[model samples]
Target: MFTLAIVGRPNVGKSTLFNRLVGKRLALVDDQPGVTRDLREGAARLGDLKFTVIDTAGLEEATDDSLQGRMRRLTERAVDMADAALFVIDARMGVTPSDQIFADILRRKGHPVLLAANKAEGRAGEAGMFEAYGLGLGDVIGLSAEHGEGMADLAAALRPLIEAKPEDPEEEAEADVEIDEDDLGEEADWAPTVRRPLKIAVVGRPNAGKSTLINQIIGDDRLLTGPEAGITRDSIALNFEWGGVPTRLFDTAGMRKRAKITEKLEKLSVSDGLRAVKFAEVIVILLDTDIPFEQQDLRIADLAEREGRAVVVAVNKWDLEENRQEKLAMLKEQFERLLPQLRGAPLVTVSAKTGRGMDRLQEAILRAHATWNRRIPTAALNRWLMGMLEQHPPPAPQGKRIKMRYITQVKTRPPGFVVMCSHPDLVPESYSRYLVNGLRVDFDMPGTPIRLHLRGQSDANPYKNKKRAEPSRLRKHLSGRKPD
Candidate 1:
């Protein structure tokens, strides 16, 4: 996917536009200056077009040895990396001195920059939209990301950049066959198709020792390690083997909390980290053992679960800790509180600097991967499910009981189960949590998202011999009955 970096001065609605384009609240939005310090990237879909959108640090005048200088350097890097830049400007404020400064930077880099005069939806922005032209950066597209008035224009502006590459031969061949007609039907008979090793992305907050961890994993300084925060500006993927498993290891920038992060490249770095999370089968979230479980740590883990990616939590800088057992217990408690969805996810303590527990981390990952890939036979799953219902019944809704009659393991790349019942929609989220816990306990699946889809029955079991079973059940009952 082509990289589109959103660059602009502070308070220019760049994050708003980013959220609009990505169709998610991935970035924090506020009417405040420098709210976004780090770069945030997302795989954006403008209708049918998919491209990577980078939300950059707000461009500002630099004061050397200051935070603003750091932000400028980061913004400069984003411009250099970007194939195109969405040069956002506040239409209500008109063209400011900062806009010219950023425009000059964009021009010097020679990247295609789309001048977006955001907040131009209403009458208030007309003059400012007009003034935006004074920056001399081509046509300014009047857009209101908050109002969502000119998204079509934004899409049109982004089309050429997104649609530049032709489809691959393999993709064309696959496309030739209608996807619906080519349905191989439940990949139930499919074996683990191993062409290459799974890509593993190790990501966390800054100074979480992401680079140190990767260096330890590969036994070399494949990535530069430093005490300074935000040292890594790019998400670097290194190829390696773990326990003889071929793998592509991606070491990503430490994700700062939204408030603290203040660089365009850091935003891009975080976005790239997310892409890796989406693309990879498993994601390892590293934490500093000293501060083992931050809110951001849990959020990263939550992202993996939400994306259906297997998660492994690694607590780095473990060697420095004095009371290892107490800290470990506290961290696990926090993990339980924050990320219940990924219950029993392997939490390994490691020192990326010393290489201690690196093997254990690899083992934990392998375990999580296996758990993620596990499949339960329908017969076994249904039998276990029946026992579960008998032990802990689902709550009734409106005096009508909900029957969870049958369950099937429809898929395994994350192990999805479909439950047939009397009322699928009536299933409470709390009870759904119960079923998930039951699935984890009964089937030995942990450290991965176990999806239980509810469908109303009279939703007959898709995998069962419904036509033959009902008549047989009746006949067996009749045969066992006493003379009346």
Candidate 2:
């Protein structure tokens, strides 16, 4: 989708307009100034025209090192990535020096810029709307993003920009791949190369260098990064190729403990990160080597496992650590004990700043994803089930032996299965775990979620046709026959 960035000074209803256009409340909105600090992108629709809409932090004048200055740089990055920009201003407040500064910056960028005089509901904003003509960008669209007014004009302004975007070759190629019947019967235990972009999400705690790692991987500062904690306030997804493989990586906000999260905005940020984790096929849990495996980190890993997503643990900032061999061993040991659900998952050490050990991390991610998508044939699965039963039979609870009948794989993408048993409810949870582990080790399926469902076979009545032979006790007593 074509990217459109909404840029303006603070408190000009940028977020309001963004939510209205995206048809969702993605960006946090408040009456307070600078409510939005990070670049937020959403899929927007104006009438039939569809494009990606980015809500950037309010432009401000500050040094490069200051927080506001970093935010401005992030907004600049958004503008560079966008196909066009919507320069918004409050009609009630008229033009300010900040507005003019940003307008000049937009003009120099040479991208199509649409000046929108926002909050112009009635004649009260008429004078200021007309005053927008002095900005020299283009004709001003008197819009009320809050009331949905002037949307037709806004749509008209966007039509040309949307139509002018050049067609992407990658998209064209994806659309042109023709499916043939011969391709469907190629192989049974076959795995094809990942032709589509691999969706990956890098996640960890606050200040764990999530964005920095991604920026290093892309070989550019595509995402805003600094030493400040919680700098990333949204789940920002960027597309680039890694070692000839097309990939889309999402840099999400750092997650904090639930009890520690008090602010509403932080809560939203955490939710967004979780959503990214769910959306991704593979999740990289970036751990700061200085403070590895905090409680929150363990929780994050567990969440990924429960979500049935492939997980890879990467210990970052290895350059600063001493005794590399010793630290690596300890990290492996810690990973096993803390997150057994993700046991045997990849644990690679890397330095996002120096770009060390990143190649290993990428390989681990691909391996885990392949394993997560693995499927076992039904005959092989049943044969493995028989071997497992012969090795260690299920324990009988309350002297009622649980009979294991047959097993078959029901689906892939985590390799789920259904075991028909005599008493499925009697199957113990420990037995289920044992089967899961055996499946992992036996089939070489490691670091992927496995599901085992037990179902009991129904018994048919034996006395349905022989009613006289199976006479009721009451009938016998009433007929004066012997109860025995």
Candidate 3:
């Protein structure tokens, strides 16, 4: 697919344009300049044309190792990777000196440049639109990415460029092939034609090396990383293949305590990270060895469990730890004590900087994912429930025996079960915990959230609530005469 990178100075609505084209709010957009700190890629569709669009960080003049400087380098890297660059300018503010400088930079790069005069919806933007032509990149296309104006002109300009590239023969052949049902084997019924990628979200407190861990996993400096906390603002999702399994990894902003989050942008970042957790099938909670399992870390892990996502606790920066054995033991003890809900979850020690223990982490993640999607047969479930009831029956509440009837798995993906009983409401919380623990042990389901629902049988008669019909006087007299 043809790849286009949206490049511009701070607060030029590059992310807005990217979101508009992608038809999803994948990137975080705020009025604050430099809200974007990493390069975000999305499958964008304009009219009938489909291509990959990259939303890059705002280009800055900083050349040193500051945060802005890092952002600049990452954006430049995007420009190099993209087939073409869509240079966006704020028409409402007119062309600034910074825009001119960036235009020169793009010219030096020698890629196809498409000048977009964004926010050109009203008369006030006309002067800036006219000023944009002076940059001499090419004919300026005036469009409002926010209001969806001038997209036709933008698409018209891009069609020739996108179509000029030849299609891959292999892709074309694969697209043309049709599957025959008769030729499929038994396994084909259960297997998916297109394997879905596993979604994993890496979350933790500020400066926990979440970005660094993802970069190491992808073996690319795809994310912006530094000593700075909260370097990542948006929850960026990247698709890649790991250990022959297709996966999508989300690098989220660090979540701090609610009282500490005073800035509006940080709040947005935190909320975005939370949304990633909800969407993820597996959540890898990255922790710093220096201060592992902080209150915030526990909160993050608990949240993932509550959200019913498979949890994997990863301790990062192990390369710097001298007392590995002692630290690992303490970490295990603490993990079991603090987060018992995620009991038996994988606790992996890794070094995101040096690429250590990543293999173990990957295995743990796959295992957790399998366990999350595990399902047991109804017969097996009922047998297990019988054994559980025999070993430790439910308590008699108010002199009434709560008969534990049977259990059946209703769904997978965290494995939800519904238990039909006489009085489900009277079941104690401790008894439920006992059953949940037994499931984790007997069924070999660990680290995955187990949802147990207790249900009572409804009344057998459907018309039990309806009033009974009155007997007619003639029918009563006939019955009395027969008896006589």
Candidate 4:
């Protein structure tokens, strides 16, 4: 597919246009300038043309090692990789010196450029639209990305560029194959012959090197990283193959305590990170070794567990820790004591800066993902439940024994089970924990959240609450003529 990078100064509706082309709100949009700090890619469709679109950080004028300078470098890198550049300008504000500077940069790069005057919905922007030609890029295409205006003209301009690229033979071959309806049924025990990318989200408090870790994994400084905390404001996802397994890794913004998150942008960033966690199949809670297992760290890990995501605890910056053995032992002890919910989850020590112990981290992630999707047979579950019952029976509350009839796995992906019992309401929380722990140990499912629900006999029998009908007259006559 053809790749296009949207680039311009801040708040020019670049992300809005990207979202419009992609037909979803994948990127965060706000009135705030420079809300986007990382590169975001999406499969975009415009009429008959299909391509990959990249939403890049706003091109800043800074050339030194400031945050804005790093953002500019990242955007320029995206332009270098993409086949074409979509240079966007705010039609209402007219073309500024910053816009002219970036246009010159794009021209020097020698890539195809498509000039768009966004927010050009009405006569209010007509003057600014005319002013855009002074930048000397090309014919300026006026369109409103927010209200879906002038898309036809935009499509006409893009069709030539998109169609000029040669098509991939593999993509064409795959497109020609037919899919079977029967294989897509709910009851079908189907598995993908082609491996899909595992989605992994790296999350922790700010300045934990989340972006640095991702950049190291991809072997490119694709994300903006510095000594500054909360430099990453978006949950940027990148696709890459690791250890022969395809993966989509998300680099999220740092989360802080709710009270400390007073700024609206920080709140948005944190919420976006949380959404990444929910979307990910496996979560890596990246912790700083210097301040390991803080209150926020515990909350983040616990949140992942409650979200039923397979988790891997990674202590970063190990190169700085001189007492490696003692620190590792102490971290393990703290992990077990603090977050017992993820008891057997992998705790890997890595230095994102030095790229040490990355192999172990990758292996642990794959293992956790496999555990999350693990399933057990119903017969095995029932047998295991019987053994558990024989060892330590359920408590009898108020002189009524809570009979556990059987157990069966209802689902996977953080395996869920249903246990039929005589009185589910009376079962104590401690017993549920016992059964869950047993399942985890016996079935070799570790770290992934296990959902065990107890169902009473009354819950299964629908007619238990239905009122019985009165005796009929014929039954009374047969019993010897009873009067009404």
Candidate 5:
């Protein structure tokens, strides 16, 4: 897909337009300036044209060593990577010196640049829209991203540049694969030739160093981090490679207790974090070494378990702690006591600041993911079930023995199973827990959610023993008459 990069100075609504084009609220939007510090990309469509659109941090004039300078460099990289760039200016404010500077930079790049005068809802922005023409990037197209006005004009401007670009050979090959499914055998299960990137979300309470850990893992200061709590508002996802495996890591806003979140913006940030958790295949619940296993940390871990995501616990800021071995032991004990749902889950210690124990953390994440995706054969499952029944028979309810006939795995990815029984309703919750624990231990599936469902075997017992009696013979017998 042709890539379009949206760029502008701070608070020009670049992210809002990006979200509008992509038709997803993947990027966090706020009235606050510089809410977006990282470059985020998504698939975008306009009429018949489709492309990958990137939302970049607002450009600012700062020294190369400053944080704003780093942001500028990242935005410049996006501009270079894009087939065309949307140079957005706040029409209500007119083109400022920063906009002119970025415009000159874009002009030197010699790529197609579409000058966009954003937030031009009505007559209020007419004079500024006229002023935008002075920037000399190109003809300015007035549009309101929030209200989605003037998209047709933007599309008309982009159509030519996008269509002029050549199609990628790799994309053509992917198209072939999609259409050539018939050539491949019609096996119900068709594994991909390429490995998809593992989606992992790093989450915890405010100031747990979630972003710091992700920055350490990816080996980049791609995210904006500071000592202040709640520095991160958006759930930023960045691509990464660990141990030769492709990965997508989501750095989310630190979740606070609901009662404490009085501001509307904080609520949105928390909601965004929850969305990341839902989309993640694996979750790393980071804990501050100073405050390991706090109430909020336990709540976040429990949420991940309820979501059925493979979980790994990470203790951050390990470098500050004294008596490493003793602290680790105490952390483990607290982990087992407080969050039994995640009992036996991997708990690795690391200093995201100093880069300690990252190797072990990566290994643990891979192991948890593998365990979550594990599938057991039906024969083995039934054999294990039989052994469990023999070891401790299900309790007799009301002096009637509850018979469990068979067990079969219905699915994997947090493995689920169904048990055929005489009365599924009679199966007690304690017995279900027993079976789930047994499966976890026997299958070596630690820290992953296990689902066990009891189902009654289908049967109409009255017709099983004999043929159906005729109604005519029954009527004659009731009248005391002999039937021929």
Candidate 6:
């Protein structure tokens, strides 16, 4: 679908207008200026025309040119991405110099421009509506963006340009795959389809350079990467071939802890990142290297393991460090200590700024992928279980010794196992962890969640068989006495 970007100075009713146009409260609307700090994109439909509508950073001037300049850069990128620009100006405030400045920039781009004079509900707006013509953009749309009045006029004004490209309902439906995502069932993850293009997710805490690393990997500024934290709001998946292996790469939002996610959009973004990890075969947990193992970092790593994904540790911003080798050793040591579940999993150091060690990063991902898909045979698993049991037998509970008979590989692609025995419930969680760790060490499965299940086959009931033999015993005794 094509895109239409909403751009204007602060408090010009951009969010209100965005909420109205998208028919959903996807963007937060408040009377405060500069409430929106990030570029928000949503799907919008006008009549038969379906397109992506982009809501941009509200233009604001900061003293000493703080992050506002960076915001302007992001907005500029939005303008470039859009096929058309929606320039909104307040009718009450009349035309500002900032409006003219933005208009000139959009004009040079030679893209279609639609000027809307918002808050024109009263007769007071007539003069301002007429004055919009002086801004040199023709046919200004005058309507109350908040009340949804004059939307038809707004649509009519922009219809000619977009109506020519009306979307097919089928195409529109396919573009928006509103999957529950939880519905993705347990199937062979290493099937030919998944192997054809490995799904790689770059996950980390905020300002960990997730977007920067993605930009480097794809070798395109396809993702919006800036020095400011939380520049990326959506978990964007792009298809490409990496190192001759077809791959679907996902660049996720810089994940902050649940407490830190104050906004609804950010919360959605973090959930989306989690979903990406669930679908991805290999996950690159990008650590900022500066603060090696924060609570949030462990939370992310634990999440990947829970999802049963192959994990690779990536230490970014290596160039910024003073003692490279020492820092790397410390970082790797922390990774090993804090994230022992991913033991022997690859640790790659890359400077997203300079693209150093990106090749090693990819190499590590493939190796982890292979480890995640490793399948152990039933015989090997049973042997390993025997050794494990001999080393540390299951303790008796209340004078009843628990028996573990045998184990077998139930499945693979995150290898799951089933141990059949008596008193399965008596097996403690610690012992289960011991078995899982032993399997990891012996079978070469690393950075994946090995699921183990226990089944108790109540040893055949001696009383039931004894009752059945009672009648046969009398007949046997009579026949033996007659023979004597």
TM-score versus the correct structure, for each prediction: 0.57, 0.86, 0.91, 0.91, 0.85, 0.73
Q: Write the per-residue lDDT of candidate 6 for residues 1-484, one digit (tens) a residue.
A: 5789998898889878887877765555667577565666666766665567778887655433466776777777888889889999999889888888878877888988899999999888888888899988888899787898778887777677776666767655554443221112211112133245677889999899997898799887666666778776656656667877877677787888787688766776677678778888888999987887899989998888888888898889988989998887888788789888777778888999999998898888888888777777778777888888899988887787778888988777677889987888887888888888888878877667788999987877768756444446568687774332
User: Which candidate, 2 or 3, has the higher TM-score?
Assistant: 3
Q: Residue by residue across 1-484, what tens digits does model 1's lDDT show?
A: 4778998988889988888877766565665577666565665777887667777778878857576776777677777877788899888888888788778878888778889899998899999988988888878899988888888888888887667756556644544343221011111111122435666888888888887788888886545556678766555555556667876677777787888767665566677667767877878998887776778887887888888988999988888999988888888888888777888889899998889998898888888888889988889988888888888899898887888888888898789999988888888999988888988987788778888899888655687875644346566678895443
What do the candidate models score in CA lDDT, each in turn? 0.77, 0.85, 0.89, 0.88, 0.85, 0.78
At residue 24, give the lDDT of candidate 5.
Answer: 66
lDDT tens readout by residue for model 2, 191-219: 12336567799999999999999999999
lDDT of 2 at 151: 91
- Candidate 5 residue lDDT tens string, 173-277: 665453212111111111223676687999999888988888889898777676668867777767667778877788899998898999878888899889889
Q: Candidate 3 lDDT (Cα, whole model)?
A: 0.89
TM-score of 6: 0.73
Global CA lDDT of candidate 5, please? 0.85
- For each of the candidates, give the backbone clash count: 13, 0, 0, 0, 0, 0
Q: List clashing residue pairs in candidate 4.
A: none
Instruction: Give the Cα error of residue 387 in candidate 2, in Å.
Output: 1.0
Runs in model 6 lying further than 4 Å from the true structure = 10-47, 60-66, 89-97, 117-136, 140-159, 162-199, 222-241, 244-282, 373-393, 405-415, 460-484
- Please state the error at residue 444 of candidate 2 in Å: 1.2
* Cα lDDT, model 1, residue 30: 62
Evaluated with lDDT, which candidate comes out highest?
A: 3
